[model samples]
Target: MKAALMYGPNDIRVELTKKPDCPEDGLILKIMAVGLCGSDIRNLTSDSRKGNYPFIYGHEIVGCVDEIGPKQTKYKVGQRLFLFPGTYCMECDNCISGHSENCENEHVAKLAGTGGFAQYIAVGGEKIHYGGIYEIPDHVSYEAASLGEPMTSVFACLENAKIGYPDTLVIIGAGPIGDFMASIAKTRGAKRIIMVDLNAHRLEMAKQFGVDEIIVSKLDNPQFAIDEVLRLTGGKGADKVISATPANATQAQSLHMVKKGGLVVFFGGVPKGSMTELDTNLIHYNNIWIKGHFGASYDQSKRAFALACSDDFPADKFITHILPLDEINHGIELTKTGEAIKVVLHPWDESFYP
Candidate 1:
């Protein structure tokens, strides 16, 4: 098997490696499509979540079952599956409370020396049952199924904010996360979906994804965008505001864009030591609700997969670039430069892509 091994920050090598054996009560998966995530780039640049050196670093995965171990009755050989990616210990308090995404031992599945970046990887260990694997529906394409992991986080944020029909939902970011948030909000009956970003190209792309309005923020003057949002919302502000970008200013602006008693979801995390100013008076007087969402639980992953399979979700539009495993480094670079919305990797055939 050939795997792309990351030896350290900014260092990755594609080399022949031994394939992993099927774990007891688990399934060995043949890599099909894996999407590059922002977190993966963070590891290569900031080294924030670099767990171990010489490790494979990919989590958004879609693969077919190649080998099924004994007692694995829930799945079979040749069955396509999408991974939840975050392995957890079911005995932890978080897992018992239905928040397995935050389980005490939660980590990328590569700690076991196998990851989606490889040709084949093993899944299902003693404590990996909570959200490790999900079978892809026949109607969903491999590219759409590979997006299951990141889409779960967007669904989780909406759940945290308790978004519902007829609400004016504002998403601050036009990247892949914001794209998913906009589509999900529109399908859930949001009356007016407003997407804000500094990138005009992304805002143009957002128009194709069902957003009611688009605001291209002025890089030097965010206030102009804030005023425009207020104007669109009739001076009351949006019913729900989601800051999906990590910019500190955007996080702060969410408070001003939300209506009285509205819910503002902080969907992205800024770098450590970075701080944003907040007006506590708004929360005290207008009763605003600020919610922070991190990861998605097992149940949320299932819901995201169902949504991806739906006919109206426009799942295919999410994939903007496709490359072979040998060119994963280029995919990662495209993601950082905002040149690609979502990049999918094909481990089997380097030359096949539609």
Candidate 2:
């Protein structure tokens, strides 16, 4: 087996490694495609997670069941599947309260050595069935199936914000995740979708995904963007404001872009120990809701899979570049440079298109 192992900040090596055996109560997957996520980029540079070193770091995964454990009756050999990377302790208060994404103890998929970056992986954790894996639909492309993980979190954000039709939705960041958020906003009843990004190319891409308006973030004057957003919303601000960028500036400005009594979703996260100041009076006087969302649960992952299968979702469009595992480093660089919307890696170098 071969895997891209992250040794430290900006250090990842593709090395031949011992293959993991199929767990007696779990399964083994021959990885087909894996998508690079923003979190993966952060992990590559500097991640504050507990299991943070000398591990593989891919979560958006699609693979074929190469081996199924004796007790794993829910899946079988040769089945295409998308594996959820979140491991939650069912005994946690968050899990018992149905907020398992916030489990007191969470082990990301990569921490267990089953990161999708590898040619093969073994999944056998106790919480695997809870929100850790799903059968990829027959018609879905491997690239599209790999998106189930990120799309699940996007769905979670919308669920938390309760965004729907007729609401003006403002999304800060026109990256792949932001594009996914725009794609489903109209379906959720968003009357007008406003997308913001510093990149002209990404903002242009957002236009194709049904964005009603586009605001280019200004480097010289950050408040200029917020003023433009307010003007676009008729001085009332957007009904739902979502910060999909990890910039502390975007997160802080999200409060200023939402209408009174509206909701603000802090979808993207900044670095650990980072802090931003917001107007306390603004939130108190406007009665606005500030929500934070992270990984998705089992049911949300299922819904995301359904969304991937829908004709309107256009999951394929999200995958702008595909590369063999040998080019995985280049793929990661492309993602970081904003040169590709979604960069996918094929561990087997096989045909991945539908």
Candidate 3:
């Protein structure tokens, strides 16, 4: 099968490999759709990691089960499934505490880990234990099902937020993650959700997603935008501000937009050593809560998968481009250049999209 792999920096090669075997209790998946994420681009550029070289980089993945494990319990052949890419060992301390996303065991990721760019890949036992293989509802198309990962991450942040009905929710950045956070905020019954972004086009796109207001930070000045949100909330800034952009600057901006006692969720993946400047007085005097969220819990992935496949909430608008796996470079470039809102890589034939 043909697989797109990362040999090193700026080197994504598509080559043939022996078809992966299905794990004893796992499933062999035929790659259908995978989303190209900002982190994938970051791996190619600013924050590349070592040791994990010659690896497959995709995490937002959806596929149909080709070969089922002989001792299958919940999964079967011919079923479409979503993946919780970060495999975790069930016996670890974190896993015992229901934080399986951080299991210390290497096999947690399994031998045949996230090779979603390939035509076929195997899932591990930890993945299955964590409900990693969620059945894609028959009603959901492959394209939309691929958004499960992003939605799960957004759900994780919201869970950390402890949002209440009619609370004002502010989301920083209008990228896919930001837009997703906005949608999640809306679904949670936020009375006023303000979406902040530098791209006017994205703000316009956010309008289509039903945000209460759109703020172009570079032009409208984000503080002014926050003031408007406070006005909308009767002079008490947003109840919660979720910073979903990787930029450290946006983290500080979230502090400014949230009220004195408001909650702030930093959901973006910032590089190591990145720092955001904040007011020390506010930290000492005000009772604001700044929560940091990382990967999604396995249970959250179930909800996110349901949300992804649901049309009532609607995430089709999130997918702005689709390209064949062989043309993955174009899709990744779209993310780097901000030329595409969301890019779905199709390992299957192109006819499925057009």
Number of the top-ranking candidate, with TM-score as the measure: 2
Pairs in steric clash, model 1: none
**lDDT score for residue 10 of model 3:** 83
Model 3 clash pairs are none
How well is each residue in 1-354 modelled by candidate 3, as lDDT tens digits? 888888788888888878888888877888888888877777765426575777777878788888878776777788888876766656788878887666678855564335688788887554677556678888888889888887877777787677658788888888888778777777777777788877777778777676878877764354766566666667777878888888887887777678888888888888788778887677557688888888766667777778788875666788988888888887777766555778898876644342
How many clashing residue pairs are found in candidate 3? 0
Cα-based lDDT at residue 133, candidate 3: 68
Runs of candidate 1 exceeding 4 Å displacement: 49-52, 70-74, 87-97, 104-114, 352-354
- lDDT score for residue 236 of model 3: 70
Assess the local accuracy of residue 194 in candidate 1 as a C-alpha lDDT between 0 and 100: 94
Q: What is the TM-score of each candidate against the true structure?
A: 0.89, 0.91, 0.88
Worst 10 residues of 2 by lDDT: 105-114
Stretches of candidate 3 off by over 4 Å are 69-74, 88-113, 219-235, 350-354
Local distance difference test scores for all models? 0.82, 0.82, 0.76
